[model samples]
Target chain A: TQTVSQSDAHVTVFEGDSVELRCNYSYGGSIYLSWYIQHHGRGLQFLLKYYSGNPVVQGVNGFEAEFSKSDSSFHLRKASVHWSDSAVYFCAVRRNNYAQGLTFGLGTRVSVFP
Target chain B: GGIITQTPKFLIGQEGQKLTLKCQQNFNHDTMYWYRQDSGKGLRLIYYSITENDLQKGDLSEGYDASREKKSSFSLTVTSAQKNEMAVFLCASSTGLGVYEQYFGPGTRLTVL
Candidate 1:
């Protein structure tokens, strides 16, 4: 079985400040990692994904995440955040083999203040 | 690009009532999934289908039933609504099951009175 963990339940940051949300996963074999953002009551929108390649993957709105194999982690980062970035972010993982659904973390709620 | 649509943005049901939520995808994807999202928690998969008439149970499939009558449509039913039960049901699809990004619908907010 696979599991995802987002340690931070809620994070508050000032506008224009850099932010990082931590994500950790445990899987036996090859896996895929992805991030999604949900604003208020809306559905989640895909941000970026990491399978294999450069450890650093860029996503929408100046957001990027780094995959660390040794750490078993994929942490999302942004050089500068805006007020619109306030939302709940989710980290998900899936195995590469079959048609199984993704296992998601509890999620990290980001609140950007002006 | 294609889109996923879920009907009845909000659902209100009584205790012991059976409610159904519908989803349709124009992406023509081969796989579809239903997930339940509680307040302040991540999504839990309820059921999934790889093709028409094929159903697979997920981690949270005990109190729910699912149907995939056609390729483009998938529906989920809550067996018996519990009092004061409130959660969001999300529907999503992918081009294929493995290693593909999922496209999510707006979701259906279910409230039991």
Candidate 2:
């Protein structure tokens, strides 16, 4: 069994503020982790992924995540979020014994205030 | 230059009716998947195919049937539409490496009346 958990359901932050959205997973064996962003009325777009080497991975739009094997976590962070960054962010785990379908966390809705 | 296309951007079906959604990926990727997203709920994988003519059940495979007749396309059919069931069906394709990011389609919105 595999599970992905996002502790925050909704997050509000002012523009230009640093933010961190938490994600935790439970899975045995090697895993691929990814973050996706969905704007209103749009499908999810891939943000970043981590498989091996360099626990800190960089993604599009200045977003980055650090994979902590010890904590079983991969939390997405941004130095300064833009208003356009307001959207739903989902964390997912990919493991093929379950046939490699992404197991997603209930997304965190981020709101950016001017 | 790759794209994943999902048909019937929005669908309204009656309870107990069979609804089918289609997906096509131009990437020629060997793996495709279908997922269901309910309001305020996490996405649940419904079905997936590793290659042409190969189908696999996902965590939420019940109440759904899937077909992968060709490598570039996969379709999913709702066994019987549930009442008031509203969800977004997402299709995705990966490079078959078993460890890669998935590219997604825009999604088909299904509404059961």
Winning model by DockQ:
1
**Which stretch of 10 consecutive residues in model 1 chain A shows the poorest summed lDDT?**
A95-104
The DockQ value obtained for model 1 is 0.75
- DockQ values, each candidate: 0.75, 0.66
Candidate 1, residues B1-113: lDDT per residue as tens digits?
Answer: 99999989999999999999999999999999999999867899899999999999988899899999999999999999999999999999998866789989999999999
DockQ of 2: 0.66
Compared with the true structure, what per-residue lDDT tens digits does model 1 show for residues A3-108? 8999999999999999999999998878689999999888888999998999999999999999999999999999999999999999999953357658889999
Clashing pairs in 1: none
Docking class of 2: medium
lDDT of 2 by residue, A12-97 (tens): 99999999999999988687899999998778899999989999999999999999999999999999999999999999997647
Report model 2's chain A TM-score: 0.96
TM-score per candidate for chain A alone:
0.96, 0.96
Query: Where is model 1 chain B poorest over a 10-residue stretch in terms of lDDT?
Result: B94-103
TM-score of each: 0.97, 0.96
How far does residue B35 in candidate 2 sit from its true spot (Å)?
0.1
Best by TM-score: 1
